[model samples]
Target: MQPLLDAILHGGPMARRRAMAKAITLLESTRADHRAQADALLTALLPHTGKAFRLGISGVPGVGKSTFIEALGLYLIAQGHRVAVLAIDPSSSVSGGSILGDKTRMEKLSVHEMAYIRPSPSSGTLGGVAEKTREAMLVCEAAGYDVVIVETVGVGQSETAVAGMTDMFVLLQLPNAGDDLQAIKKGVMELADLVVINKADLDPKAATRAQAQITSSLRLLGLHGNPEHAHHDDTLWHPKVIQISALRGQGIDTFWAEVSEFRRLQTANGRLAARRQQQALAWMWERIDAGLKQAFRQHPQVRRLLPAMEADVAQGRVPASTAARILLAAQFGKAPETIE
Candidate 1:
């Protein structure tokens, strides 16, 4: 393990890849020892991170997400960019395993020297991606990867969590999927930085019509509507919509060019730096919350006090809010002292 850790710090291409794979495996481990080592490795790797662009791709099931990523990833590698994909398949709560195997679909990219593909089980979390997805991205970047693509499970449910963590959120859609234009939730569409109309070569005519309908629908999303002729900022910027055939490798270059241009504009406008800062702050709070939860559970006094407080509330002897205050005070050994 020490040798592997050392290799991670100063290894060549193959060694680094090996270290990365080991690091990711440790991160995904449920054991405390593995987690501690993984945390240390991540701390060491943090400085080399934040140099790559992080993009999140999400959509409904059967949206060709895995296929599109394979095509796009290969394209990027051909352009001399080292690519890393963190594919998250939401785990089944009953069985706690993945049904859709992203790695199997992306066999080519998985073996490419310039590419690394990791499939993470979502562990029944609210976010489509796992909690460690961000950490995985950092590991890849630290290994000198140029681009990090996060692919979330294709469920049309709310994906605000993944969207908030990425530089750009790409929404993928198919042709003539039963008026998908009307069925898509507005909030989901608003989060999209780019929309790709995939499977274009399967049925060109149908794809074209579907593209037009989706474009028109997205345009409507960008318009501010009001009954009293008073319009608020009820719309977001229109996301670029591109037609692509991921299987045939059509329009991939054009799609990537648009994405690169959007990235450039975002950086020039200062949004990129701003977003990174926000993500950092969010991560800080997340860890703090996790630590607090762990501490509260492990502290002997809190463990004893929790049941008593719950019983008091249940029996109507104490209000739930009052119990919460007491618990907080007990856990911190005081009512939370404020610096301000």
Candidate 2:
């Protein structure tokens, strides 16, 4: 563990890549001993974290997410910054594993010395993210990477977990989306900090029309939903839509300029710090719930009683609430409330 940490923090690019991959795997491990070691490693690396911009990028499967991420990553690298890209692929529900094929998609970025690309399986996690992705981001930050991009296999309705953890959320849209609310109808649209209509060069007019329509839709949503952003102050950032050709690399510079502006405004207004604090608290509770669930499932008495109770409930021989009380009693020595 010490050697891995040293290599990650002080070694050459190849060495750091090896060490970083190993470190993230350690964090992703569910073994009790590995979890303990990972917790300690995170504690040691805490001070070195929180220095990067956390960006969440999400779009439909064919929305050119990889193209945009690779281009943006290279652009950031040329500006003398280390960039790390983490792609979350959905796991096969039957096999409980993911294809993890995104690294091959970003061929150039994958080999760049200034960049690190990791493809992580969602492990059946909601939003298609490994529970440890956040830890991996911190590990990258500690390794001096200043930009961490979390890309999701955007599926289903509404926002994924990426929106909750990132400092900024960017939603990619199709060029000819037009005024179709169905494209952004899911609650997910409300979470975007910025919207980009990619493949704009393919149909410039349609792209422009999509941009205006999305902009108007956002304005209406902001009015009805995010009242805080409705009357933006100098420090407040109102979500804006832009057109970009990720493949051609057009508008990359302009997009980054907006990101920089957001960082400045968010920092000056204390929104960034406040948001992190809230996220930290929320993360703690999430972990606590996860830990309790693990304990409940693993407790000897609960384990012994679970099958029969599950069968009884499934067979309609017992009420679910009654079964829940029995499991809780086995673990807690008493139910919180009377069940029957």
Candidate 3:
């Protein structure tokens, strides 16, 4: 593990790739021992983490998210930046298998010397994000990747989940999306720091219209509507809409420029630091809640009574509150007094 840590921190690019992969695999493990080792590795690399730019991208199934991401990845590599993409694929609800096919999807970018592509399964999470995505991002950063892009499966509340973890959240939309704001929920739109109208080359007019409609709709939401909108007057960053044809690599440079601008403004205004602090606290609470639920489910007494309590409540033989009290009390080694 020390050798691997050294390779991750000081080895040449070629050696770093394998070490990075091995380290990330450890981080993703559910085994109790692997988790402890993963924690130790994270402590060793803590000083190197948080240097990368975290970006989250999502869109509808046909919105060209892969094309856009690969295009942007290639462009960033050409600019001498090492990129890490955490592509989250939907898993089979029945078989619990994931195709992990993102490397195949981004053929050129996947093999780029300056890019690392990893595909992870959602494992039944609504967001389709790997449970260890945040840890993986830290590992990439520690391994000298300057850009970490987390791509979600783009369904339901997944977009919001991605936004909660990344420094910048980008939402991609197709040209026809202009006709119906209903295509994306208002809540999701508000989450975006920037919006891209992809496949714009297919219909120049439609793309233009979509950009206008989205920009207008954003303003109506009162989040990114005003150009002067800022957390502070000097470092204001008003979200805006842009058109791009990712497959053809059109607007790729402009896209990066806008992203750079967003970073600059956020970094200057202290919002970037503030947001990351908030995310860290939020992540802690989420894990604590999950741990408590797991402990409750695995408690010996609660496990013994849960099924019968559930049945009684379901059949109206007992009230839900009474059943809950019974189960909770059982966890603490005391029986609740009976209710009428």
Candidate 4:
């Protein structure tokens, strides 16, 4: 563990990349011993983490997310910034497998020495993000990557999950994305720090319309959605809309300019530090919920009763609520009636 930590913190580019991959793999492991070591490694790396900018990007499928990310990543690298991309690939629900083709899609950035791209399988995890993505991002930050980008699975709606973990959440949209009332729905758009219309060169007219429509929708959300999300405060960062052609690399500079501004404003307002604190607390509770669920399932008494409870519920012989209580009682070694 010490050796791996040393390599990650002080090794050459190749060595650091190898160490990051190994560390991330260890973090992703479900083995009991591996988890213990991964926890220790994370504790050791904590001091070195949180220095990088965590940028989360999300959009619907076929929105050219990979194209845009590749463009942005290469641009950042050229500016002397080391970038790390944590791309989440959706796993097959039935087969429990993933293609993990982000490396193939991001051809140029994947091979760049200043860029590190790690494609992780979502594995049925909700929120379009992989379970270990946060851990992997910390690994990249500890390895001295100044910019960390988390690319979600593009599964739409529930994709808002990435926003909670990232410092800045940028939502990518297609030109036609604003053609309906869906744009005003209360979800991902409300959380965007910036909205980008990608592939604008394909249809300038549509892009312009989308730019206007989304800008309006965001304004409405800022006014009516959540008080905390309101952009009316001049002191706080207001979300902006921009058009970009990621395929042709147009507007990449403008996009970065907006990102830089957002970073500056957020940092100055102390929101960046506050947001990270909130994310850390949220992460702790999320892990606790997961741990409790795992322990519940693994409890010997609960395990013995679960199959019967499931059968009863499926057969309509027992209410799910009652069966859950019985299982809880069994796990705690208490009388089932006492639970009710």
Candidate 5:
């Protein structure tokens, strides 16, 4: 155990990666012993964490997300920063795991020495992001990675989950794709810290016009998106929209500059620390919720009561709510109100 701790604390690159991989596997395990070990590892590593910039990127399908991240990651590495990309792919419920094939898409970044790429499956989780993705980010930061990028499954609701975990949420889009005025639904647009219009090199003229149209539409909706920092004195947070061609590596440097500037503003205004604290608290509650669920499943009374409740509902002898109350009473061996 001490050797393992030393490996995690003072290991070289390969050793650090091995420790991180082991730590994540422990985090994902369902065994009680593994949970204890995982908690210990996180406790030891906690102080070494939180230095990396956590950025989340999401978009609709076919928004060239992989390509864009590769371009952006490589650019960051060239600036002498270590980068870690944690991509959460949509999972297959039938398989109970993800294909985790993002490495095939991000070829250049995957091979770069300064970049660490991890492709995690959604694992039937709502966010389509692994439960340990945030923990994984901490491990990477402790291992000396400077930037942590989380890429989420692109559906609107899934993107919201991703947003809660990230410092900056980037929504990517292609010009002229959705509806008239390059229309993205207002619900998704409201979450964007920055928007990127990709595939600009494919059709330059059309892309330019589409960007302008989308910008105009966003402004009309009171978005006025411009990637500005909102401090106590200023509540305006205007998201920035930039045209980029990930495949052609166009505008990536400028886009990264915007990201750096945003981070600087956020850190200066204390938003960065506040956001991290909020994320940590949310993580704690999530663990509590998961623990309660596991406890319910493991309790013998609850397990036995579940089938009986289903039968009562099917027979119309009792409403589902009443059945639920009875099950709760049985599970706790007390009145429902007392249980709560």
Candidate 6:
């Protein structure tokens, strides 16, 4: 553990990248001993973490997210910033595997000495993020990456967890996105700190229309959803809409300018620190809930009765709620009759 820590904290660039990968892999392992060591490593890395700006990017499947990310990453690297991209690829439910082809997609940035890209399988985790993505971000930050980008699996609506964990959430859209009212209705749009219309060069007029429509939608949502936003406070950051052509590498500088402005405003208002505090508490509760569920499943009594209860529920002999109650009672060492 000490050697891995040393490599990650002080090794040369190649060794540091290797150590980061190994540390992230350890964090992803399900073995009990691995988990203990991962926890210790995380504790040691905590002080070095949080220095980097965490940026979360998500969009629908065909929105050219990979292209946009590669362009932005290269642009940042050229400006002397060390960039780390944590790309989440969806896992197959049947086979529980992912193609993990982000490295190939981001050919130049992936091989750059100043950039690190880690493609993680979602592994049945919802919200379009991998289970250990936050841990991986910490590893990258500890390794001196000043900009960390988390690219989600591009699942449309339910792709929201990234916003909670990231300092900024940028949602990508196609030029034709505004043609459907469904885009405005998606909950993911409400969470976006900035909306970028990618591939705008394909249809400039359509992109302009989308920019207007989305800007209006965001304004209306803000007025109705949050009183603070309704006031249009300059101190508080409201979502902005911008157009970009990632394929042509246009508007990347403009996008970065908006990001810088958002960060400046967030820092000035102290919301950045407050947001991190809230996220830390939320992460703790999320982990607790997950741990409790795992413990419930592993409880000897619950495991012993689970098969019969599942059969009963499947046959409609027992209600699922009742079966759940009975299992909970058994896990707590109470008689099943006590559940009712």
lDDT of 4 by residue, 5-82 (tens): 999999999999999999988987779999899999999999999999999988766788888888999999989999
If the candidates were sorted by their TM-score against the true structure, best first, what order would they fall in? 6, 3, 4, 2, 5, 1
Provide the lDDT at 185 for model 1: 60
Higher lDDT: candidate 5 or 6?
Answer: 6
Q: Each prediction's TM-score against the native? A: 0.82, 0.90, 0.91, 0.90, 0.85, 0.91
Query: RMSD, each candidate, Å?
Result: 4.6, 2.8, 3.2, 2.7, 3.6, 2.6
Scored by lDDT, model 2 comes in at 0.83
**Predicted candidate 3 versus true structure: per-residue lDDT over 1-340, tens digit per residue:** 8999999998887889889899888987779999999999998998999999999998877688788888999889988999999855554344342224556668888888788887764456643244577888888999999999998756556677788889999989999889998868768888898999999999999999989998988777654445465243656777789999998999999999999999999999899999999988888888778778889999999999999999999999999998988888888777676422
Residue 85 shift from truth in candidate 2, angstroms:
0.3
Worst 10 residues of 1 by lDDT: 228-237
Top candidate (lDDT)? 6
Write the residue-wise lDDT of candidate 1 on 1-340 in tens digits: 6676666667887888889888887877779998898888888788888998888898777788888888989989988998988765555444343323666777788789888877664455544245677778888888878889887654444266667677989988786642556676668877787888888887788788877777666566655432322343223234667789988889999988878887887787687889889988887787678777878888887888998889999999998877877777777777633211
Query: Which residue runs does candidate 2 get wrong by more than 4 Å?
Result: 92-100, 127-129, 156-159, 304-323, 335-340
The candidate, 1 or 6, that scores higher on TM-score is 6
Q: Write the per-residue lDDT of candidate 2 for residues 195-257, one digit (tens) a residue.
A: 999999899999999999989888999999977867867768999999999999999999999
lDDT by residue (tens digit), candidate 6, 242-290: 9999999999999999999999999999999999999888888887888
Off by over 4 Å in 1: 1-6, 30-33, 92-100, 121-129, 154-158, 220-237, 305-318, 334-340
Model 4 gets an lDDT of: 0.83
Candidate 5 on 1-340: residue-level lDDT in tens? 5566677668877777777678777776769999898888888888998888889998766788888988888888888999988866555344332214557678888888677777664365653244677778878888889889988755436666677788899888886643464356557777777878899888877777877766655564552433332222343345667889998999998888888888887888788889889977987787788767778767799898788778889999889787777777876788866644
TM-score of 2: 0.90
Compute the lDDT for candidate 5: 0.75
